[model samples]
Target: MAGFPAPQTPRGFGSGKTGMRTRTTRFGRTVVALMLREMASRYGRSPGGYVWAVMEPLGMILLLSIGFSLVMRSPALGNSFLLFYATGFLPFNLYQRLANTVGTSLPFSRNLLTYPAVSWFDAISARFVLNTMTQLLVSYVLMVGILVVIDSPVVLSFGPILFAFACAALLGLGVGLVNAVLFGLVPVWQPIYRILNRPLFLASGIILIYESMPPLAQDILWWNPLLHITGRAHEGFFAMYTPQYVVNAYPIGWGLVLTALGLLLLRRHHARILQNS
Candidate 1:
């Protein structure tokens, strides 16, 4: 009420319209401010901050390539193990980074949420945009670096890669939305959620090829939407690799459902959550 404008409406049952519009406008402004603050504090504080994103995956790809090259002769998809793992890990890393940060955005920005202008939605949205853009930029750098280094014909298809990255991010956002509220309200769910999701990276198609897995394994992992997105990313990166088991609808469907449900729940319980926080 303090930061928000006092909306003057007729003494009638149509107050909902004005109230909703007021909150929406305020939320938009609050999210923008939060984003800028995060950008400055999170990235601008240090000279090497932004480069960490690129450095993280670059180190992983190099280590994997060097270590695995000795044991395994060739990669499952491409000749360059660096390219193969980069395609798989970059998207998964994006999802992981986004989900973890977005899920905890409220608590991390709890001080800001105390202000009337900043709401839970604004905090989460700010983190989502900042992290997503950073991850996308990091992915582009790593992908381009790999292509340039590889001594082979590069066939780039933007559509599928974009779709796969989009799905991965969507699913991350949806899951983060649900987890954010859960952890923010309960606190105990934080440890439990981490324990449950400890094996997520391993299962996200980074270490193993999806199509090469056994039938039962595929059936079990089919429920994981990330598996589909990760596989599709590889398909996009390597021109010749066609993974038959990757279903586009799987991740999209789950992402939509999770996101919608999380938003509905959050909208209904936002005030209670703020009070608890």
Candidate 2:
């Protein structure tokens, strides 16, 4: 028998591309893989998994619309109440889901973090991507359903809706990253997060516009960036909708600032935290 050639080691095996590809490619691949993993784990096997994501929000909208229209006798939101609610509620849900999921991401992925290829950002990105996609799908389904049910004149304006969702995602991701880092630092942060996030549902412009409020109240609500996003989203869906609310540059600015800070913190401390855990 011919002597077997020495086993050839794979190129880049010890050169940082063995398990992980090159940095840029690896980062993209990791993010995408993590996103897929999350989708599969969370919503793949069950038939209702993905459908429920859309249905849950739609149900909330229907219930709220009926309650407001029949029981509360609230003024009509717009020609298409379901559409209006979809525009506002979907983005708000995205923000809330992203923030909540990301807040617990690090701890949630502690096991995966043992693998060198898996980074903290990968975990956070996975959750964010999953939540973002789910919310967008839900929004689209609700929008179409509303048009069919209510027969409202739906304008397919891409600009405002795109901007609104972008802003919402950015804001949510920034807050989530910060919260995740903090939670990784302090395990007790979960209870505090729950308390803080619960109040946000009411404060965020889910059911009403900020402009409809009194001056003082409007001034106060103006500080919330979600209000601006909801207003802009509604503007996209309904012709009559306009954002009269004053939103300072702070919330948007804070999103950028926090994201940067969170990334820096994650880069520096994430590995250590993983090792400690």
Candidate 3:
């Protein structure tokens, strides 16, 4: 009896911190597996894969730079049209693509969701993390390329830029969660959402600066969270230009409110929605 070893406790069934760690580990593994699967299906099967991701955005930036160069001597904020448009377009694109991916996360992973190990949160998280990383990488590359190629004397303020990116990502996630429920249940909301989303680029200060817009336009667009995001981005990239109308609380509020509503709805109706699907 003196030499007998102490009995060992079970791994995952333990109380308090052990159980919490076990749950967190399981969720992390599930999310990672889903992310791997998504990368394989979405990019590995395609011909060009991730290359297309960079090309598409780069092409848009180039076209915008070329078109605007012909019309005007310089861009609104900076002499380099590429930098101005990249700052606006990249963050907006990140939000747009993230929202689309997260919106379809449940439907896309429907079969997998049936398994006990997988969950709706895991599915959404996989899409959100993978896509967000991809977009951020693309943005970094394109922005660096523009800065190097143009060799412009630009000073970047990371505070507003990081804030802008955070707002965009959270806003995308928030809207996507709500859309996920609506798209899964209503079925007709998908097309309607797309129709409504088309004008965001034009209205979001991507092609046009906010201060240049007429007062009426500014007043109307002030409510758009994307506009605030873009304004923050411009403030980061263009040191001289600061937008007085950009309110940090407005976009943050939209993100938090929409996310809360979406999570609440999902918690309440996810089972029925999944079953119906």
Best by TM-score: 3
What is candidate 3's lDDT per residue for 4-62, written digit by digit as tens? 98998876556868779889999999999999899899889775999998999999999
TM-score of each: 0.87, 0.85, 0.93
Residue 107 displacement (Å), model 2:
2.1
lDDT of 2 by residue, 1-277 (tens): 3687878878767876645556878888888887777778778877789888877887888877777666544433575556666778888888888888877777777887778998888888888887888787777777777788887567666777887888888888898888877777776786888887787767777776776677887777777788888877877876766665535355578679878988888888887656544
Better of 1 and 2 by TM-score: 1
Give lDDT per model, in order.
0.84, 0.77, 0.92
Clashes of each: 0, 0, 0
Measured by lDDT, the strongest candidate is 3
Off by over 4 Å in 2: 1-21, 72-76, 246-251, 275-277
**Which pairs, if any, clash in model 1?**
none
Compare candidates 2 and 3 on TM-score and give the better one.
3
Candidate 2: Cα lDDT at 3? 88
Of candidates 3 and 2, the better by lDDT = 3
In model 3, which range of ten residues has the least summed lDDT?
10-19
CA-only RMSD, every prediction: 6.6, 6.3, 3.1
* TM-score ranking of the models: 3, 1, 2
